[model samples]
Target: MTDDTLAEGKAADREKWKEKGVALRAFFYIFGTHVFAGFVWLLFYLGGHAQK
Candidate 1:
């Protein structure tokens, strides 16, 4: 294949991997935040009840 064609192919593959990485990072970030927040809220809710 020509140099330009090969370069384009490599670029396309790079973009595909980058998109996948971004999506995976976003998923972990959001999931972790929600999980942590849920635990924190649960702690507060339980603590308030314990004081009563």
Candidate 2:
């Protein structure tokens, strides 16, 4: 109703849309998981036993 309350609500809405979990948390989570998975697959692909 008041300007002060409106400002606070706007600030909280902005913070809620920050998406810190998706951007920061997921950056490390997906990045680490994919990177490790890729490394493991690379080893298998380039292993001593080839599919010639």
Candidate 3:
């Protein structure tokens, strides 16, 4: 294949990977937020029960 063709293919692959990365990052961000919120809620629940 010509150098130009090879370069284009590489660029396309890079773009595909970038899109996947963005999606994975978004998923992790959302998942992490929920986990953190749950942890905080648990702490509050325990504290409230302990006071009684």
Clashing pairs in 3: none
lDDT of each: 0.98, 0.88, 0.98
- What candidate 2 gets wrong by more than 4 Å, as runs, is 20-36, 39-43
The residue-by-residue lDDT of candidate 2 on 1-52, one tens digit each, is 9999999999998887787655898789989999999999999988857777
Which of the two, 1 or 2, has more TM-score?
Answer: 1
Residues 1-52 of candidate 3 have per-residue lDDT tens digits of 9999999999999999999999999999999999999999999999989955
For each candidate in turn, the TM-score is: 0.90, 0.52, 0.76
Clash pairs (backbone) in predicted model 2: none
- Model 1 C-alpha lDDT per residue in residues 3-52, reported as the tens digit of each score: 99999999999999999999999999999999999999999999989955
Worst 10 residues of 1 by lDDT: 43-52
Clashes of each: 0, 0, 0
TM-score of model 1 relative to the true fold?
A: 0.90
